[model samples]
Target: MTAPADVPPEFLDRLRPICRELPESYEEPAWVGVRWRIRKRTFAHVLTVDPDHQMAYARAVATDEPTCVLTFRSPVDELHALVAGGHPFYKPGWGADVLGMVLGDGVDWAEIGELLTESYCLLAPKKLAAQVAGPAGLCC
Candidate 1:
């Protein structure tokens, strides 16, 4: 699938390698940005154009700088702690199981990679998840 026209190439350049590492994950346009999905389930989605999303994330993150929001699945128990720990993340209005994190300067790519891996494992089929899990163990 082609990268969404609205998504910045620089962001995609950094994101592609992480997403592609997951088994059977594919990128495509969804809503106003891009999403990585496994079969029918979307494990990660980006919101780059919507003003409401931007404002909400900026408010949650307490930053006015232009930033892209990446919403991804997290373990139900870890969701609260992640956002509460001042990690530049928050819970999306959509649900409690998913969390939104601001992606911009000073972002930790290694952590992002781990989050993406966990999100993919959560949405991918068992066999596929197993293939990707390997030595990483289940969700990080």
Candidate 2:
């Protein structure tokens, strides 16, 4: 897939390595920005939300400026705690397991890496998923 012109190259630079490490994962251009997938299932998607066009994300974050956003799947048990904090995180008005995060200053790349790993595990086929280790430190 061609690189998405809307997403900042720097953002792709940070995300590409983490997604690449997963077995069988690949990058593709999404309708909006870009998405990383394990086979056909998307685990992580990044897009820039312009309040003028995307009201849902703009309202969710309550920001007037264009904001870069990353959406991913989170385990149900951890969803509330992550979104409850609010600022950088929010529940998108879609899938039960889907969550959106505002990406900008002070964002944690390490945490993003861990979360993306978990997201990949959740969507990838069982055999392929088993080939890669889960996030560091916490247990299933």
Clashes of each: 0, 0
Best by lDDT: 2
**What would the per-residue lDDT of candidate 2 be over residues 71-96, giving only the tens digit for each residue?**
99999878789998887889988899
lDDT against true structure, model 2:
0.85
- In candidate 1, stretches whose alpha carbon ends up further than 4 angstroms from where it belongs are 1-5, 52-66, 134-140
lDDT of 1 by residue, 3-104 (tens): 222556677788889998887789988856889999889988875633445565557556554457788998888888898886678776666688888777
- What's model 1's overall lDDT? 0.75
Model 1, residue pairs in steric clash? none
Model 2 deviation from native, Cα RMSD in Å: 3.4
Worst 10 residues of 1 by lDDT: 1-10
Q: In candidate 2, which residue pairs get closer than 3 Å at backbone N, Cα or C atoms, i.e. clash?
A: none
Model 1, residue 114: distance off in Å is: 0.4
